[model samples]
Target: MTITTAPAGVSLRGVGRAFGDHVVLRDIDLDIAPGEVVALLGASGCGKSTLLRMVGGLDTATSGTVRVDGHDVTGIDPRCAVVFQEPRLLPWRTLAGNVALGLPRDLPRNQRDSESRQWLGEVELQGFADHRPRQVSGGMAQRTALARALARKPGVLLLDEPFAALDALTRLRMQDLVEDVQRRSGTTVILVTHDVDEALKLADRVVLLGGAPTGVSVVLDVPGDRPRDHHQPELAALRSELLAGLGVPRRTPLERETHAR
Candidate 1:
C-alpha cells in the first residue's frame, strides 16, 4: 500500500462557530504545518473539539475560513481522517472489515483488504484482523479504530480525544502508539484532549482554548525529543502551568504551609 508522504497543512483564519444564539468558537486563527503534531487543550465545553471538527470538515464554521493544503474545506475532504473518543466500529464487521471502510471504493477488493491488514499491523493488531469489535479489549478496539483511520493514508488526522475513554494505563499505551504512528507516517495531526500531560507527551505544540466563545489562550512549544518523559522537571513545570491555565488550582507555598499548620 502506498502512504502519503506529504502531510497537509491546516489554516484557520478568523474562525468562529455558533449554534443559533450560542457561540462555541470565536475569531480563532491558527496554522498547523504539514507533519506537525498539535494538541488542543481545554476544559470540557470550551469548543476545542468544535475547532477540530471545522478543520476536519465535519462541521462548518459560522465565520472565517478553514483551509487544508491551501484549499478551503467546504465539506468532508477525502484527504483527511477523523477518530473520535469511541471506536465507533460496526458490531457486525470484523476488524479487517472496519479498517477496509476507510479505503477508496474504486480500489480492488483484494487491495483494500491488503491495505486494511497492513494498517492493522501498523497499530500492532495483525493477528486480530478477523475478530469482531466486541471480541477485543477496549484498547484493541481503539487500535482498530486508529488503523481504520490510518488505512486511508490521510494527509491530515484529526483526533477528538481518541484515548479519553480508556483507562489510565491503556490511555498511556495508546498515546505511545499514536506518537509512533505519527512519527512514521509524517501525518499532520490535530488532537483535542483535556489531559495536559497527554498533550505535552504527544504534541510538538499545545494550544489552549478558554473563555466564553473560546479562542486560543496559549500556545506552548514542548521542549525535548519524541516520547517525552512525564516526570521530567521541564514537562512537569509545563504541565503545572497548563493545569493552572485550565483552572486547576495549585496551592502556593504559603497556602501549603498554612494547611500544614
Candidate 2:
C-alpha cells in the first residue's frame, strides 16, 4: 500500500442550491484543509446529498462557487472521482475491467492493464480480478467500485454513504478498510453520511447541515488524534455532541420572522 498523500484543501463561497421554489441549500461557506476528510452530516431532506453533488460536479449550484484545491469544478474534472452508495458496476464487466474503465483507452494496452492491476491490488481485491460484479459478495463489489475511483488517482474523493447498503458487520469492515486506505493514500474525502459513528470515525471535521434552507448548522472538529480509534472515549464523546446538535429543535418560519421583528 503506497501511501500517497492527497491535496484536500477546499473552499466554498456563498454556495447555494434550489429546485424551482424549493431552496435546498443557502449561503454555505466552508474551508477544508489539505489532506482533510470532512463529513457532511444531516438528517434526511437536509440537502446533504445536494451539497455533495455540487462539490462533485454532478449537479451545479443554483448560485455561488465550489473550488477544490483552488480550482472550480462547475463541470467534472479529472482531478476528482465519486463513489455512490451502490456499487454501480457493469454486470458484464470483471473487476479489472471496471477499474480499467477509469483509464483512457487512448493509453497503450500494456499501460492500462498495469494501472488497473495496481489499483485493484491497492484496494485489496487482487484475487477477484476476473470475477464479474454479480459473482462477488457485496463487500467485494464495493471494493472494486472503490478501486475504480482510485485508479484515476484523483485529488479528492466524494463518497455518498458508500457502505449504507451493507450489513452491519460488512459496513464496519468497509469503514475500517476506508480509513486504512485513505490514511495510506492521503486522498481528501468528503463523505455524506447520516451515521454519526461513521462520520466521527473518519472525518477530521464534521459539518452539520440543517435549517429549512439547509444552512451549515454546526461544525465540530474531532480533537483526539490522527488515525484515531473509533472506539476511543473522546471520539465517542464527539459523536454524542453531534447527536445532540442534531437533536436541537428547529423553530417555525413564523417564529423566526417574529424574532427578526
Candidate 3:
C-alpha cells in the first residue's frame, strides 16, 4: 500500500453547518498544516463535533468548503478514517479481523494481517488480536479501534474523544500512544474534545469555540514539547485560558479574599 502525506494540511473556507433551524457552526476559516495536530475545544453544544463531522465528510457543511489533502470531501475518503468515543467494533469479529477490515480487499490475506499486526504492536496490543471486543477492556477496545484506523495509513485521523471513556490512567496512556504514533506516521490529526487538559496535551493548536451559534473564539498555539507533562505550569495556564474562553465562570473576589486570609 502507498501512503501519501496530506496535501497542504486541511483548509476550511467559510465553513458553516446547521440542522434545520439550529445553526451549529457559523462562518469559520481555519487551516491545519500537514502533519499538524489540531484540537477542537469547546463545551457541550458548542459545535466542536459538528466541525469535526464536516471535516470528516460524515456530515455536509451547510455552507462553505471542506477540503482534505487538496481534495473536496463530498463524501468519505477511503484514505481518511475516524475513531469515535465508542470503540464501535463488531462484537463478532476478532480484534485482528476488525483491524484488517479497513485494508483494501485486493490485498492478499497475509499482507492484511501483517498490516494489522504492525498497528496493534504500535499500541502494545499484539497479543489481543484474536480476542473479541467483549473479551478486552474498554482501554483495550479503544486501542484496537485506534489501531484499525492507523492500519489503513490514513492521511488524516479524526478523533472525537477516543479516550473519553477510559479510566484516568488509561486515558493518559492512550494520549501518549497517540502522540508517539502521530510523530512516527506524520498523520494530520484533528481531535475534538471538551477536556481542556486533553486538548492542551495532544494538539499543536487548540481552538476554542464560543457563543450560541458557535464560532471560533480563541486559537492557542501549544508550543510545549511533545509528550508534554500534563501537570506542567504552561499547560495549566493554557487550560485556564481555555476554560475561560468557554465561558466557564471563575471564583468571585469574595472567595479569593476569604482564601487569601
Candidate 4:
C-alpha cells in the first residue's frame, strides 16, 4: 500500500533573488500542477536548487511570492519535504529509526510502526530496516532518505540532485524508484538536476534556468510518458534545445559540420 497525501500545487510569481550587488534570478514566474513532475535543468549555479528551496521555504526570495496549495510560504512549510543530494542519515540510527523520524508527531503511537514499515517498503528497504546507516551502500542510504521524506506524507517532494552521488547504474535505479514511488503516491515533485537525460526521462516538463544574462529561464513541455526511453527519437530535438540553452554542444565538431552541410 502507498502512503499518499493530497498533493499540492506550487506557484511562483515574479520571483527574483540577489546578493548585495549581483542578481542570480529575476522575473521568474511558474506554476507546477498537483501531482505533476517538473525538472529544473541548467548548468551549475543556475539557481535551480535555489528556486526549489524557495518553494520548500528553505530560502527566501528577494522579491515576489511563493505559494503551496495557495498559501504563501513564510517559513519551513510543512506541505513540502526534501531529499537532498546526500542521504544525510544518522550513522548511529537503524534505517527504520531514521525513517520513523519523519512520521507525524501527532500520529498515534500504535500506527507508527506500520507507517514506517510501509514507507520503507515503498523504497524497497523493508529488508534493511534493522541495519544501521554504516552498514548499507550509498544507494541504500539514499533510499532510506527517500523513504523518510515520503513518510512525511508531503504534498510536494523537493529533490535536489538526489542521485548525483550514486554510481551510474545505481543512479538509474534510484530514478526508477523515485518515479515509481511518485506515481504511486501522486505527490507533486520538483527535481533539480544538471543531467539532461535524467530530466527528460522523468519530467512532464523541463525548465532550463540560467544564461549569459543569468536567471533567464525557459520551459519546455516534454511529450511521451513517465519512465520514458532515454533515446526516444522524439526527445532528441528537445535535448538539443536544452543543451543549446545551457550553451553545451550536443555533437562533436565533425558531427556539427556534417549536419551543417
lDDT winner among the candidates? Answer: 1
> Candidate 4 at residue 20, lDDT?
74
The Cα RMSD in angstroms, rounded to one decimal, for candidate 4 relative to the true structure is: 2.2
Ranking by lDDT: 1, 4, 3, 2
lDDT value, candidate 4, whole model: 0.89
Tens digit of lDDT per residue, candidate 4, span 1-261? 657789999999998888776888888889999999999998888788888899989999999999999999998989999999999998888898888888989888778877887789988888988899999999999999999999889999999999998999999999999999888889999999999999999999999888643564689999998889878878888888898888886864446779999
lDDT of 3 by residue, 1-261 (tens): 333444337889999988999898998999999889999988887888888878878899999998887889887776578899999999999999999977777999888887887778878998988899999999999999998888777888989889889999999889999998888788999999988888888889998888778888989999777877767755666776787787785544455679999
Q: TM-score, each model?
A: 0.94, 0.90, 0.92, 0.94
**lDDT agreement of model 1 with the native:** 0.90
| Weakest 10 consecutive residues of candidate 4 by summed lDDT | 209-218
Q: Give the TM-score of candidate 3.
A: 0.92
* Alpha carbon lDDT at 178, candidate 1: 93
Task: Evaluate model 3: give its lDDT.
Answer: 0.85
Each candidate: RMSD: 2.3, 6.8, 2.9, 2.2
Which of the predicted structures, 2 or 3, would earn the higher lDDT when compared with the native? 3
